[model samples]
Target: MTAIPNETMAIIAGGGHLPQLVLEGARSMGLRVVGVGFAGETDPSLADSMDAWQWQNLGQLGKLIAFCKKQGVSRIVMAGKIHKARAVDLRPDWRAAKLLWKVKNTQDDVLLRAITGELESEGMSVVSAMDFLPHLRSPEGVLTRRGPTSEEQADIDFGWPMARQIGALDIGQCIVVRKRTTVAVEGLEGTDATILRAGELVGPGCVVIKLFKPIQDARLDLPAVGPKTIQTMIEAKASCLALEAARSLFIHLEESLTLADKAGISIVGLRS
Candidate 1:
């Protein structure tokens, strides 16, 4: 969320609201957008908003870069979810294969950093999605009608570092807890699926905690939650949310807070 570019910027889009959000932000700032979306990860309808657009396979790093260079892009903002499990479906071309061969492990941060390095070497800066969607970031404080109850606060205290530990291991960014017992840890199924899985496991009254990984790259991905996340928690009958304040993105803020307030869900923005 620093200074927005006035020249054309690139949206390395994924799915859901990501492309549209960046498009809207870029348009508002008078920056024309050039987009390249991952094949199965991006919405096709978003092609209309791009001054230049293309759909690329997951491992077509060469083609992706070439397309951006062709459109004279200098800055790139990546948004939306790219399921790591999609590695199973990866069809790596020479450039991507070379990059993969140099990596020691396939952890999200490691791979993303490698990709960022690759982009930077080519004179393309990789920026955060939050740069375009700054309003979605939740500030530090209680965000709903109530703060976490003592018992819920206990659960948050208990789960917070555990979430951080898994994050340190680069496992994932979320953990579900109830009365200090771990319910479900996110395993690439995503936060929403993790919440629903926890609800199914323990049934109601669970606390969901999401954090920014200790080793996370601030310029890249920060975990995102939104109105849809609240809707999922409501459906799961989860009681509270303890998200890292000033670190997490709370998209659709008013609607999400309204949903949480109506459902009597305690949403405290946890400061690290």
Candidate 2:
């Protein structure tokens, strides 16, 4: 594969370790990174790692674009999580307001696609986060030491399509199932909360499935799993995790796998 040419890239960072990972990946490839971080959503320590950085409110599209232009950034990558619930309470700037008004619905895909279109219109291309850090993508097959049993495999088979349907509808990317019965479907509350809710309803031995949306834009909101995910599953007593291979991001893979193995949790990457 050809390397991404060394140039200043703008990272529109939100929350979690992903933004930091992307920055390290870019720098390792001899590219300079300028980060635009959301105030409440982004980690504060992210500023220390950037060649240049600016903090903006979730709805400050104008400021974000301006900052990228000033930094001479032509390519952009979005990383991290932006809580959909918090986005509802945004105080949009004029540009953002205009974009919001134009969209028929404020579904995750709709809103992000609009923002991406606006950025592209301004001569900035948004690239997939995986392009900069392909290693983050999970490989096909079982990752943890413990592979799923036949029963747990059945639960994954039952849950994967349902998760994908919800994802395609822009509802969510995660679902919790126990013995082929879905106990919880993720909403704006997110994966951890959904898993906890499932545990409350169905007790232990649930299979958690997270996957990329069938119609998802590769450049935005790819499904991600990490150490925190394994920790949450342990807390909820979820037995198995099924992630879409090549389409999902796995952060802290070694630590996450070690923790999963210790807990006897089975983690498999499916090629769907």
Candidate 3:
């Protein structure tokens, strides 16, 4: 594939290592990257990795749009996690206020959908987070040194449809199963918390399944996992993690797999 064009690519970041990865990916692909990180959430070190970086609170829609325009950014990608709980303190500008009033639902999809449309209306096209970081996309088949046991495989197969259904409804993108029964579904608390909760509820050998919602907008968000996921699984006594291959982001793949191998946790990236 050709390298990313030498265009101005703006990254609107929130929290987690995902934004940092996105910056690195963009730079490697030959793009001039500018970053807009959220206050108190995004890592400040991200600035060192970008051509230019600025911080803002979660509700500064006007500032974000202005920053992009000033940088001559034609393409934008958003990465990292923004805790919805923090919306309680949101201070929206006129532009953001108008968008908020137009949106009927405050659910993740509704909010992001509105934001996407707002950005597009302002002439800033949102690029997929994986646009330059395709390698972070999960690969098919078993990824860890050890494959899942028969029982774990059975759990994965059993939970696959249910997980996808949950995802389709936007209830969550992850489900924890044990003995073919769901233990926990990931919602706002996120994957790590969900896995820990599942372990507590189901005890040992629970299988975790994570997949992109059937109607998920790849340009905006996708379920993500990393090395910390393996640690959480091991702590919870989980035996396996089945992620939707190529649809989910596999952050920190090398360290994640190393930890999984050491913990005897099976990591499988599956299609469907």
Candidate 4:
């Protein structure tokens, strides 16, 4: 594919390797990228990955906007997981505080939507996370060497609706179920912890389902799976992971698949 014109772009980074992945995408697209990474949340390695990097506190909206303007960035992308717990230390400048005041709810989606609006109003468009890495989108199929067994298929059908219900509640997107019983539900603690917890409690052979919330904005909160997800399943003794095909991102695909195969775990990109 031809690269996007090298107009400056800005990344409001969070935690995880997603920032690094996004940086790679931006550079490959021929975009000169500037990054504003969150303190205590974004990985430090991001600085070396970007064209220009600036570390900023999580709530510094005005500063972020100014930095992008200074770097001549007209398109912006926000990626990675910002620990929700860190919101307690939010130090919103007057601009951010004003935007926050306009929002009636502070759920992750609500807040992010507000931020997107605010950024757009400031003349910077928020680009989709997959703008440069379209291949990362989950494809339709049973990705692993082995497809889900009959029992796991039963669990997939069994847990699909319940898992969606959990996502609807804004609680979390991942649920580990055994025999139609939810052994673990992902919360702010995140997916790996939830899976490990389920493994310890449910023994073995649990099925893990991770989906992007039906209400989630694909441009921002797309569900993602990676090598670490495979490792979590291995540790949890889970045999299958059913993720939403096309909507989810499969990071480090070859390595993740290799790990899953070694662990005898099945990774399915469920159409649901």
Candidate 5:
């Protein structure tokens, strides 16, 4: 891998393992990583991986930008998930309040785009986390020991476009289907909840489809799945998992594939 130019990169970390992965990737490429972690959302342990770290609440955009500028950071990467429902109680600073007032709605893409624009206006470019670790991107074709059966493949084919449509509308990235029938569509509750809900409604053998939003800014909010996803599928009795290849990040790929195979689940990476 080519080393990044001698510069410090600021990571705007949210939650989950992705932030740490991005930090490690940046360091491996010889870039200094300074992280600004969300108080409730980001993993507390993530601070250990950074050259310097500071904690801030979700709505402290002014502080985040100020920190980046103080550290002389020109590039920023936003990684991991932020639970949207929790934003209801966020104590927004004046800058964040101003940005919030400008947006008509709080949809994921709209809010993220506004945030990106805010950072760019301050002379900092927001970059995709995948640029640091391209290997984490899902590869095309079957990843598990078994490919999806004909019925499951049919369900995948049926659900793929619907997933894209919802994603294009910035509704969600994942949908659960059984025998070509919609079982559940993920919303604010998130992917795991959506899968478990499908299991309750359909009993078993449902397929989960996750994809990137067709109109989404790829630098922000890319779809991701990990070991916890397979665990959720096992509990939900989901039989197949399909993710958009190269656009979605698959964390712990080997371990996830092993668990899926052992549980008799099929995983496929599709170009769509």
Candidate 6:
């Protein structure tokens, strides 16, 4: 509910190239960013870019809150990838344990919303990375040399709403379809893995669809795709990718397009 705070903010740095990109964006806006990294998931070298930071393990919600309060950071941005499957290794402190028990299930939205509420209850604003990295939003149109073929487009049409329905159920944001048949639904392993798995199940010609979950908080966890996504589609021999345009983050657009074109893969950003 708070406006983008100009003074100080903490980024809950997860993994991948996104954390670095977000840090750079905060700098462009003249805001001080305190980086907080999750152990084993975050790249530690990223610490060098922070005004102040800490490497904390998962399930240390109390420590995360304590650090933010001590550093006087009132706004928080959750950025990058945190594998939810890593829950097996979590050692929850009192705050995190209480939160876990409070949620009816560990579905991504449920758990994340609880965590966001906890942070807000502590007087900190949970903001979106998109505010600082607006250019990353996927533009509406074909992104590669080729748009989907008629059949491929049909697959996209069939899969798009299904992906949205899956998202609405708070399941996952991605699905793979071929010839109008669902090949795979993304689980905690993530989009890339799900695409590759679809290849194993259905061979080539699969269309990958990723959407922004309908009930998702706009302030955190926007769907993202980029060069890595193109690479995965190529490896999966996927024929095309359909993203929720303007709602999804398309990272490294140029590079991703080049890769997709090279692989004869089609990438389109569709309106939801």
**Which numbered prediction scores highest in lDDT against the true structure?**
5
Clashes of each: 0, 0, 0, 0, 0, 0
Candidate 6 collision pairs? none
lDDT of each: 0.87, 0.90, 0.87, 0.86, 0.92, 0.90
Instruction: Tell me the tens digit of each residue's lDDT in model 2 across 119-237.
Output: 99999889989987898889899998889999999999888888889888999989999989989998988898999888888888999999999989999999999999999999999
Task: Output the TM-score of candidate 4.
Answer: 0.94
- Model 5, span 43-106: residue lDDT tens: 9998887888889888899999899999988789999888878876688899999999999887
Error of 4 at 50 (Å): 2.0
Task: Give me the runs in candidate 5 sitting further than 4 Å from their true place.
Answer: 1-5
What CA RMSD would candidate 1 show?
1.5
Q: What TM-score does each of the candidates earn?
A: 0.95, 0.96, 0.94, 0.94, 0.97, 0.96
Q: What's the TM for model 5?
A: 0.97
Model 4 misplaced stretches (Cα beyond 4 Å): 1-4
* Candidate 2 ranges with C-alpha deviation above 4 Å: 1-6
RMSD for all candidates, in order, please: 1.5, 1.3, 1.7, 1.8, 1.3, 1.6
TM-score for candidate 2, please give it: 0.96
Report the C-alpha displacement of residue 101, candidate 2, in angstroms. Answer: 1.0
Worst lDDT run of 10 residues, candidate 1, spans 1-10
Output the worst ten-in-a-row residue range by lDDT, candidate 2: 1-10
- Residue range 96-184, candidate 1, lDDT tens digits: 89999999977888988998998889998888777777777877888888999999999999999999999989889999999899999
Residue pairs with backbone overlap in model 3: none
Summarize candidate 6's per-residue lDDT along 136-205 as a digit string, tens digits.
9999998788989999999998998899899999889999999999999998899999999999998999
